[model samples]
Target chain A: MERPPHFICIQLPANPEYVLIVRLAVSGLANRLDFPYEEIEDIKLAVSEACNSIIAGSPPGSLILVECDSDGKTFEILVKTQSVDENDGALVPGSEQDMGLHIIRALMDDMEYLAKPGSGAVIRIRKNMSA
Target chain B: MDIKVDKRKVEEGLGIVDILGEIDVYTSSWVKEAIAEFIKEGNYNIIINLEGVRYIDSTGLGVLIGALKRVKEHEGSISLICTNPQIKKIFNITGLSKIFAIYKSEEEALAAHKEG
Candidate 1:
């Protein structure tokens, strides 16, 4: 049997206030990886943008899952929201009302989107650590 | 996102409006209102001291940029005194540094306002 990788996961209510705590945590993690201050700030903005996206998409009483893992050279961030109306199409960023994902895509190195059951979506990013 | 605005009587025909708080999307309206109120009251010479403000989102930047445009057209100018490096970077990155005269200290901003 293969062992799962070590990671930090947080399940929390969909709220804007939680972004600040996430910023602080990402800062610490990025600093531990010797990321430059500029990179750290980018990480903070990336996370905030992701959380804001989830808060905007999720319905009431839904959960936001945030996961982070370090593979000795790069950091991966995965944010999943278990709230979506599959009947509706994917949300568009900068379409008169959505700017969150636009900002996230600008800050992160790599981004992946997965549409899931129950109107859910998972976004994953690989944040490159400074060499 | 609380706001505290203080008006200081500077030299002849000039006043300073010092604003403190988080000027995010929600509180940015308050900032715009405060500036508009001052402009309407003919207290256009303004210097926003953001040393106490630790955070500012894009909406806040928009408010500042909007006010600068409106006030400049009326022969009035604005500057921001931001000591926080993080907030200063946001201002610079968002190009408010070039649009508005930025000073490191309130006194510097006030002196520049008087000289200009």
Candidate 2:
């Protein structure tokens, strides 16, 4: 049987404080899932790093959408920001100049980048909950 | 997130700090300050309680390592009470769990301190 989807989207303000908001939400969700304290923290940091990536863009917009899904065993976090398919060197993920890329990679099980169908940049973070 | 630091008298003059909060980039300074403040006060027996903190990052790990360095310079002591596996992984990844004494609980850390 296919798993039920557990998803939620948070409209974040383009600000650093929003990082804290994402942290709090992820922490709470992790807690509800009975995630180990340390794993919960890991999730929290992953979410924060993702949000920070968007925050670095400092795009002139409100609401950086964060979609989350959990299957009681793994958690998938997606942060969609205002951007189209423009690899502006400054925003490239694997560049030596970007700190967020390294942090996100180190903290999560898997990280994927996708340009929105119409517009924007979306980063997805997936992690195993029981691992 | 909230961080409250505690200071207590120790037989060997070890400094201890109670860390309460998510230890991410946004809040790691709170831990850094606790250790820095202790070092400045000339105390080195440090035992950080992670029973309260659920999240930690490399920045957070780096800060802990920094504190450990400061304590080592003065021949001081630093330990950790990590109840969460996630925080434990960070320490393990950074090889800090080997350098710093990590206990299962605050009581165990304090007991080990007494034996040392």
Candidate 3:
């Protein structure tokens, strides 16, 4: 039998003022997993960038949903936007000069962009604990 | 987030802006406005002290880049004082370490500016 991953979810208004709260929650979760300080910083930065991008591209009054899961070996976060159009600019991939996307690619072990029908965009980022 | 501009350097066409707190999307505009004010006042030689800053996002980085461009228009420069390794790593990863003058201490940055 395998142990199931523990999941944590947070839903907040799509506002920049709440970004710090998200970072604090994610940092606390990562700290509980015994992640190193430097790795924790990287995870926080990646998550912040994802949230900022979503807030920038989404319409006003949107909601952001953050999902985190870990099994002690790896941590993953899904930053999703709600009340956004399917064709919103937030869902579109950024160009080479997009520093936020670039930082996410450099810091995270893996990343994916999901554009679900009527659910806005999802930026999924993962980090391996031992890596 | 808060910014303090050094008044003593104003006469020398230099602006020393010390920033404290996280420089993310919400607070980056403050930095942009501070630098823009410096440029508008003809103080193009700017020194941004990030010693009090523990975190900075891409929007903050973009503001710094924009300030650099604005200063360059007048043949001025922007020097940064950053002691945090994580923040330094972000500059390295973005390849901004090559284009910007980053010093570990304010003394070192001021000395280099004087030498230049």
Candidate 4:
């Protein structure tokens, strides 16, 4: 049987200038979890990309929320932004502006983007312990 | 959170930028601006020394790509001196290793420039 995951959450203004704080916090948390240095770097890059995506897709002054959950063998992260409906379809490729999402997809083990319609879009990413 | 770009003329048409600090969304714009300023001054061949950069995100990668494009537009080149294994892995994962010239040290990159 699997154990319940421990979760940590953070909220910040949807400002591009503050994304570094999120990266720093997650780096420390992942290090505590004993993630390899390389994996920790990937985690930081993935989360930073998610925050950048949210800030680009959302309206100004909206609050950004980031949540991290960890079980013994896996780690999960969710980023919620008050922004456009990502449910329409995958964004156009090679647009330059949306490259952040593609980079996140490449770095994280698994990724999903859900749009909450009027509320915002949520980007969820997961990484296994073995990674 | 803070990024500093120190520029020095290596030769008549070459310049070096020493980047000190993390490069993320908060600081990538500053990097872009510094590179743009270098290009505006007709420093076409640019070498970015990333030895002091502790962290870089996708936004930071994009900024570098933008700088490369700007240099290429002027028929110039951008070489990277990055020794950190983590940063090198990111470049490999993103396939940026194929896009830019990467060297293990600034001296090696400078030598390669002379050879080319």
Highest DockQ model number:
3
**Model 3 interface CAPRI class:** high
lDDT of 1 at A90: 67
The CAPRI-style docking tier of model 4 reads medium
Q: Write the per-residue lDDT of candidate 4 for residues A1-131, one digit (tens) a residue.
A: 54354677788999988888899899889998899988898899899988887776666779888889887777998887734434446433223336677778788888877654445577888988874
> What TM-score should be assigned to candidate 2?
0.67
Model 2 Cα lDDT, one tens digit per residue, B16-106: 6777766666677777886798778777787877787756666677788898888888887888888687667767655677888999987
**lDDT of candidates 1 onward, in order:** 0.69, 0.71, 0.83, 0.84
Ranking by TM-score: 3, 4, 1, 2
Which residue pairs of candidate 4 clash? none
In what order do the candidates fall by DockQ, top score first? 3, 4, 1, 2
Off-target runs (Cα >4 Å) in candidate 4 are: A1-5, A82-97, A116-119
- What candidate 2 gets wrong by more than 4 Å, as runs, is A1-7, A14-16, A26-42, A52-65, A69-76, A80-91, A95-107, A113-122, A127-131, B110-116
Q: Ranking under lDDT, best-scoring first?
A: 4, 3, 2, 1
Worst window of 10 by summed lDDT in candidate 2 chain B: B1-10
DockQ for every model comes to: 0.25, 0.20, 0.83, 0.63
How much does each candidate deviate at the interface, measured as C-alpha RMSD after superposition? 3.6, 3.3, 0.6, 1.5
Query: Per-residue error at B83 for model 3, in Å?
Result: 1.6
- Write model 1 residue lDDT over B50-102, tens digit each, in one string: 88775666666778878778777878877888777777766665556777777
Q: Write the per-residue lDDT of candidate 4 for residues B24-114, one digit (tens) a residue.
A: 8889889989989998999999999999999888778998999899889989999999989888877887889999999989899999999
In candidate 3, how many Å is residue B14 off?
A: 1.4
Select the stronger candidate by lDDT from 3 and 4. Answer: 4
**TM-score (C-alpha) between model 1 and the true structure:** 0.69
